[model samples]
Target chain A: MIGRVMDAGPGEPPIWVMRRRATAWTTPQRRYYQLVAALPPLRDFRRTRVLPMSQRRLEERLALLHPEDLADLRMAVSLVSWRRQPINRTTAEIAAMYEECMAATRNRALRSTVEFRMNVRTVMVALRLKRLGRGVPSGRWGVGNYTRTIESRWTDPEFGLAAVFPWIPEARVFLDQGDATGLESLLMGLLWTKLSQVADRHPFGFEQVFAFAFKWDILHRWLSYDAQKARRRFDKLVLEATSEYQDIFA
Target chain B: MESLVLTTGWMGIFSPLALGAIGSMIGVGRGGLAAAGAMLEVEAGYGRFVGVAAMPSSQTIYGIVVMLTLNRPVSVANSPGLFVLGVLTGVALLISALAQGTACAASISASKSKAEVFGISIAPAAVIEGFAVFVFVFALVLAGSIPR
Candidate 1:
């Protein structure tokens, strides 16, 4: 997605809104961003291979990595340096899972500042969940019947989304005929797809949250500093990406 | 073609269809995302890899109980509407299955992204699956029960 970042144009609200969501990442999330930004997809190397790696071969490759490789993967997750010991890439995947969630919840209004800001909060909530390890209690337990033990609480921190987000005054409501359950599922699905786009291209050592956040902040700052001038630049990126994907996905 | 909606929507689920608009709003997984860039698809992918997989099968379970309680006997010969209902519900189940499959795809896709595995492209694959489920459940509910 960042491949086209140099190309995002302010004329297109879609790219601008995405840029906003991209801006809300925590320092760690942005670190992963820069690492991804500074690299391109592994496909550059894959083109040399005649046959694609099989599922088993791929799994073996992932499982085969040594401890150093694990550390390299961690380097991509956040700025903190840990042992270069190898661990499965699966650990970092949880956040990478929901990359393009904002795309799925698309609404004309959400593309606007006020509504998308709500989405940013929701994303932050999700990030908090990412921090909390699974199998822990969210506190509601038997009463509200939470599936996970309150992965991370904010909606009442005392309550849940059931008690909070639904009624938040500033929250922008998107019209979805699907149940809340289905909505969650859809957001997750899209996130994985987008994250995969960036993750697959870049190496494990390069991904980081703080770095990307900084870059996003930089662009955001640039945009804020010179809205008229940056708008021209932003439009260039979007027009170019639109043209690129037109050739690709088209 | 029309059933009574059966039992005031037990557990507040009026089938995936009745809650169609709402399900797309509150659920935790990308089972219903419309495209590859969809939010649910992304979340589901990440959710699965960390073993933080979201709720699955509960809706179907509730759906079954609701079906049995309100439209008992699985009758094929008597109610013409049964056929349509079965077909429709089948579509819903199929859509639900689609969401599940995307979740599965997301699980693997998560690995693909991490391992830098190429060739297997990632897509906001939840929508197509939803379409299937939508059709399958419709068939299931409407099957042999046209409510003559």
Candidate 2:
């Protein structure tokens, strides 16, 4: 099934193609014994209120990575990071970004991590569109290998992917109930588990370093989700939205 | 054929020291890198990390001892026994040193963050050293019977 999708063309290559390419590249195994030893261990995001190592300290240790590996790591992180993308980016633009990032990433584990993240994001978007009563989106509506599977199985509750992604039903419940925090927490938890698996496979290698950095990002994001801070930001946005209208009425 | 057998005997005698030193160099390098890295994360207890890094060096000592025990005159009668025992001991010591180095590095990395686990974390490396000692002792006992 995946091969059929890849044979279609470069314009709409499946996610598995990225995996195949990543394997073919075979990034040289460089041990970062000193770097791995220097960095403090990271606990699961749910288990900690404070980050074991600060961003500055982590970056200091990451500086020991080979220059090419460091660049690849940064590129992979930027591609997956929600904050790094502008809100106004079109589907085509996002698709292009994915293509460029996947092409440039040499590490197999990092590429797989990025691929996993984008697939999750694509699924979430499909769910959101369904909730809004939008029809099966056409012409590059989202990024990842599952775009076609999602569209063809638009009516299926789990898009025929329940076996591969068991959390989809639970995510749908969160979406329907409008529990944004619950949904966000679920996504982070899943990513954290995935990063852990990746780290275990590539100990003392660049893949492990990337996994640590990605986990730190998740921890940082999770800790920053203060209700009071979010409420303040919400109010500020509301005030800005209505400020111009208020002047016109007066 | 006689000269070849003598040459083989000589090679076997020095194999333990040569192989053990090579293994020690790699093993120590791995542990030392980890120790140096750990130093960046911890303020005190620097001595323990350095100490653990030196754990693989014992293999070189074992190798030297085995070499001395097998250093008898090379002859057709005893050459085969010397060759087998010395080479076998060297290979065992080499493998043990390499494995122990990785264990030591892992222990150092773990203990640096949670200092309480320091004592227990080195247990694996200690177990590996015990295996090297087994080979060392048996090699000595066997060398005495090699018609020296």
Candidate 3:
């Protein structure tokens, strides 16, 4: 899958293609002033207890996007989303998906945003592999530009890229201590910061919209982890299950 | 060459109105789109959004006044002055209107979410308008000395 993705076609690199397409099609001149203004500001994920905008409302607002942009955004989201991957999907399939997403995304900011998330995922994978005392497997085990560096520098504590990724040491500590929740929180915080910067740099533009959507996703995911809510949902499910059995016995 | 310069003077005299109108059209369009979008999310206070959208319209008025002020006979002497002043004023108004429209759209979008910020959010647009007024006032004052 990695070989297929790398040699998909002969032409410009994906990054260069993305840059050229972005300049030609996704110039900042196309402002969504009304759409942007209509959406509410998203609070930081860590600080947000309740999502300011519901998923339905967000979808409704997103409907205002140009059809092409909406399509691009959907494709990008599917690729970069932190949602659990399907159990059956092979690593090669995931790699192919990432390649497809990068090729199709026309916006530079959006493409780079996806790249950033993928790089983070790659780094996390490397860390996990290291923690497991495993050697870097051949072929594309991860995405982004750092795959080669990670493979070669697998023994380095920070994979010899500590300066590039300042949070590696902290993330390493979390991983070492088996602090899964802490590591997740740190990763989300890093992405949140990146999205915030993107939104700030491109206010009232497509980049801002993409950033908001991703940030909203993060906030929604964080808020759904309430123990009380989970307990209530668990109880409701159990009650429903028991009621079915009761009816059968009756 | 002389005819061309005079013709340029005439073009300059009308440039403000034409350019200012174009700027206002875009500016107002931006603000109006934001206002309309905000209306979907909001229940009341729609009037204020419309009012904010109209902020960019002031540039057109300034353009009209500049056009009138620069409306003197087009001679070689006054042609240069008219051309310089009219074209420059139009450009300024055009840019300011475009910028203010963006500011107004931002204000409307922000204020719609947090009602408290409605008043304060417009400060940036107001500041941009202040700059437009400076261009307007100075253009008028300078028009008096343009070999009219």
Q: lDDT per residue, candidate 1, B46-94, as tens digits? A: 4333231233334355355435533544333434344345434534554
lDDT of 1 by residue, A202-243 (tens): 422222222222223223322333556668899999999899
TM-score: the better of candidates 1 and 2:
2
Model 3 per-residue lDDT tens digits across residues B69-109? 89988999889888888999999999999999999998999
Displacement of the residue A29 alpha carbon in candidate 1, Å? 38
lDDT of 2 at A158: 94
Give the top-scoring candidate (TM-score): 3
Interface DockQ of candidate 1: 0.01
lDDT of 2: 0.85
Question: Tens digits of per-residue lDDT for model 3 on A86-178?
Answer: 899877887877777877767878888898898898889889888898886577678777887887898898998998999999999999999
Q: Which segments of model 2 are wrong by more than 4 Å? A: A1-26, A82-84, A227-250, B1-6, B76-80
Q: What is the C-alpha RMSD of each candidate to the true structure, in Å?
A: 24.4, 5.6, 4.0
Candidate 3 shows a clash count of 0
Model 3 CA deviation exceeding 4 Å by range: A1-28, A227-229, A232-250
| Model 3 TM | 0.90
Task: Show how many residue pairs clash in every candidate, following the order shown.
Answer: 146, 0, 0
Candidate 3, TM-score of its B chain: 0.97
